[model samples]
Target: MCNEMTTSLKTEVLESPLEIVLKGSNTKFITAFKELLLHPVYSRPTLQFIESSVKLAPNRARVLAESEHGRLIFIQLLKQTESWYSGEDNFYLHLLNSIISQLLSADLGNLFLSTFSEPIVNEDERLSLLKIVDAAIDSLLERKSTTLDCQPLLEILFRDFTTASAQAIPFIRSADTSPEYSDSLLSQLTNIWNRLIVLLDIYQTILDNQPSLKPEILKDNIIEELVSLLGEAQKSLPRRSKLADLEKSASKSSSGNVSDHDDLDPKDFPLIKGKIIYLLGTLVQENKQVQDLVRQLQGLELVLTNCIIDLNNPFIRERSILCLRYLLANNPENQDFVAKMEAKETVSEDALHEAGYETELVNGKLALKKRT
Candidate 1:
C-alpha cells in the first residue's frame, strides 16, 4: 500500500506542467529559475536550465531588469542555497555568472541595480548581490560584451560599486576588520571586498589570457566592447568633470596636442581607468600583431596615460602604473612615448606604485639599447 501511494504521487507530480516543461524544454530554462528557489537535489535540472538559457541568451541576453518575466526568474534564482557546489554547479555557476554580467552591461546595469533595495538583510544576500556585480565586471572583459544597450546596466553597477566601496572603506581601514564574522557587521564588508577582488582577478584574466582567445572576430569584438564598457564609467563622474575630460581626450587624441596636453581636462572615472589600463596591458603583450591598428592603439594609450595621472584612487593608480610598466618593458615602440609622458610629468615619478616596476625598467632599457 505504501509503495502504491508513493508511485501514484510520483505519477501525478510527473504530470504537472512544470515537470513536463522540465523534461521537454530544450533550453531547460524552466528549471534554472526554479532551481534557484528549490533544493540542491534539483541541481541536475538547474544545470540543464542554465545551459539552455545561455544558448538562448548568448552574448545579447536581455538582462532580466527590463523584462518583467526575466526579473521574476532572477529573483527566484537569488534564493538558492549551497546545495549547488563549486564542483557540480561550476558549469551552471559560470553560465549564470555570465548572464548576470550581460545583465549588468552598461545599458542594463542601472535597471538591474535599481531593482534591488538598499541594505540587504544579511551577508549571504549581499554576497549574492556581489556575485552579480562581479559577473558584470567579468562579462565586460570576457566576451567584450559591450553594446550601446548595456549602458543602463553599467550605470546601475557603478552606483552599486560606489555604494559598496563606501561601505568597504571603513572596514578596509579598520583594525578589527579581520575574518571574525562571529559577531561583526564589518566582517561582512570584508567578505564583500575579498569577493570583489576575486571577481576583478577573474575579469583581469581576460586581459591576462588575451592571447588564447580564438578567432580574429572575437578578439576585435573584445577590444571595442571593452572600450564601450569603459566609456560608460564617464557617467559616474561629476558632470563638469565628465564634459571637460570628454572635450580634452577628444581634442588631445585628434589634434595630437602634445605641447598643451592640459587643454583637455581629465575625469576621475575609475571603471574607465581600470578598463583602459587592462586594455593597454593586454595590447602590450601582443603589440606586434596590432601594428595595422597602430594609430587607434596610440590614441588609446594617450588617453590611458592622460587618465592615469588624473586618477586619485591608489588602486587605480597602481593598475595604470602596471599597464605602463608592461608596455614600456615588452613593447619598445612605446619607449619614446613613455619618455615624453615622463618628461611632461604625466606619469608619476613613483613607478614603485605599479607592479613589476624594476623588471619593467630593466627590460625597457634593454629594449632601448637593442634599438640603439
Candidate 2:
C-alpha cells in the first residue's frame, strides 16, 4: 500500500514544481512531497515540511525515524538530493543539511549516525555520506543540540575515522615504493586526504562547540593512535612533497574518482598535518587531563617538529607552535620534555638564518631562534 502510494504520486507528471501542495500528514502527502521536490521550486516548502514533520519533537522524530513511512521519506532524500552542492545559499544543499541535523538531534539510538558508521564499499558514496554527516554535525553544534544519547554517536564517528585511517594509511605506504610511483600515489592519496579533511573538520567542530568534552574525547586513549599517525604523516611529508614535484615533472595526470573542486594535490600533506595539530591543540587546550594524555604519549614533539617554515602549509608553523603551547600549558612535565629535546648535532647560526629564523641570544649566547 505504501509503495503503491509513493509510486503513483511520484509518477505524476507536473509542468511546474509549484503545482504540488502539502496537505495533512498522511501517506499521500508524504509521497506527493517527494515528487514535488523533484522540481527545485518547491524545495523550501519541502524542507519546511520535513523539518516540521521529522523534527516535530525529539520523541516524534525518533518514533517517525522508526516508522516505515518515515524511513521511506528519509530514503527519498538520499535519492532526490546530492550532498556535494557548493555555495552557502543553495536550498537543495541546505535541505540536505537540515534533514541530517534533525535526525541527529533526535538521535534515535544513534540511528542516523549508525548508518554512516557501517562499512561502505563504494569510496565515492562513503565520501558523500561523510560530507553530509559532517554538515549535520555542524548544525548540531551550532544549535547546541542534545539528544537522549550522544556517546554512541560520538563513538560511531571515531570508529568511522578508524576505518578511514585503515583505508588511507596503506596508500600512504605506497609513497615509499619509488619516485616513479608518485603520480599513482598522489591520485590514490586524494581520496584518503579528502576523507581525513572532513573527519578532522567534524572533530574540530564538535570540540569547538563543547570544549568541556575534551577530556571525554581523550579518555578513550585516542591520543596514542593520533600521536602515532601524526608521526607517520610527518615521516611521509618530505617524501610525498618530493614525489609531488616528480609527478608534476612527469605528467599532469588526473583521477576521475576524486572531485576537481577539492583541489586534491599530492603535496598538500601540510594541510592535513596542520589540521591534526589544530585538533590536538583544541583537545589539549586548558584541559589538564588531555594535556597529560599527550605528555604520556610523548606526542609533544609531533607538534614541535612541525614548528618550522613550510611554504605548502601557510600557517602550519604557527599552528604547531600553538599546539606545543597547549601541550605545555601548566604542565611542567611537558614543558621540561620539550625543553630537553635537541637536534642530533649543534646547529650553525647561518643555517638557522637560511631557514627564516633570527637567533635570540641569552645574554652573549644564543638560546633560541624566532621566525624573522
Candidate 3:
C-alpha cells in the first residue's frame, strides 16, 4: 500500500502543470523541490531534474516570469546566496549559478528576451525582470573559475536590446501630436534606453573584473550600432521654437500641469546623448580595435560636433571630449585625420588674411580678425 501511494503521488506531480508546482505553497512536492533548489550539494540529481523541467517546458518558464510570486521566490534565492567562494554556506549561489547555465542551455534565455520585447504593461514589473536578469548576469560574472559560459546570454541580450531600440527610434522621431500618444512613445523609448544602460553596466563590470570578456563584447557590433544611434539621437533633438511652443501650450493648459510635456524636455536629449558618448569612451578605452572602428566610422567628427553644440552643458561637453580622446589616443590614423581637419581650418583663415585682413592667434589661440 505504501509503495503504491508513493508512485501515485509521483505520477500526480508529473501530470500537473509546471507553474502550479513552482508557485504552489506548502505541498509535499513544492517543499521537496524548494529544498532541491536550495540544496547545498552542487552536483545533486534533484537540481538537475528541476533544470531539465525548465528546459523542457520553456513556456512554463515564461509563465513563471509573468508571476509575481515566482519571480520574487527566484530573486530571493539569488539574494540569499553568498558568493561561490563563501565556503559551505554558498548553496544558493551555487544553485543559482547552475540554474543560469541551465536556462541558457535550454534556450529559455531566448524566451526571456521575447517576453522582454513585448509591450510592458507594468513598469515596475518590467524593472523587476531587468533586476532579475541583471542578477543572473552578476552571478555568472562572479565566478572565479574559467569554466563559466556567459557569451550566449550576453549575445542574446545585446542583439535583442539593440534591435528593440532601433525599432523605437522611428516612433520617437515621428513625435506624434497627441500628448498621450507622445508620452507613450517617449515612455517606451525611455524603458528601452534604461534597459540598454543596464546591459552596458554589465559589460563595463565584465571588462573591469574580467578583461578577457572584452573581445566577446566588442565582436558583437554593439558599439557600432550604439554610435549610429547616438548620431541619430543628436540629429533628432527638438528645435528651440518647438520647445517654446510646448512651453506655451503648457502655460495655457487649464490644469496648470506640464507633466504632458515632460518628455519633450530639451535637456533630456543632451543627457541621453552624453551617456552614449560615455559608453563609446568606455568601449574604446582599452580596446585598440574598437578605437580603429570608431575612427573608421567618423565617430570622432560626431563626438566633436556634439561637444561643440553642447559646450554650455559641462557634463555633455566633458563626456564628448573624453570619448574623442579615447578614439584618437595613440591612433596615428585618427591623429592624422584631426591634423588634416585643423589644417583645413588654418588654410581657410590664411585665405582671409591674404585678402588684406589681419588674423592673429591670441595667446596662441585662433581668433577671428576684425577689419581694421
* Tens digits of per-residue lDDT for model 1, 261-308: 233222222233454455545665545444223324354344344334
For all candidates in order, the CA lDDT equals 0.45, 0.59, 0.56
Q: RMSD, model 1, all Cα superposed?
A: 15.5
Count of backbone collisions in candidate 1: 20
What is the clash tally of candidate 2?
0
Reference-based lDDT, residue 143, model 3 = 64
Which ranges of candidate 1 are over 4 A from the true structure?
Answer: 1-37, 50-73, 81-89, 98-110, 117-123, 132-150, 176-182, 195-372
**TM-score of every model versus the real structure:** 0.41, 0.68, 0.53
Q: Give lDDT tens digits, candidate 3, residues 233-304.
A: 656654333456545654756566644335344323324566677778888885677888887876777776
lDDT for 216 in candidate 3 is 78
Ranking by lDDT: 2, 3, 1
Better of 2 and 3 by lDDT: 2
Best by lDDT: 2
lDDT of 2 by residue, 137-254 (tens): 7766666435323455567667767776776666555544534546665655665677788888877887777666666677665677677667777766552245565355335335
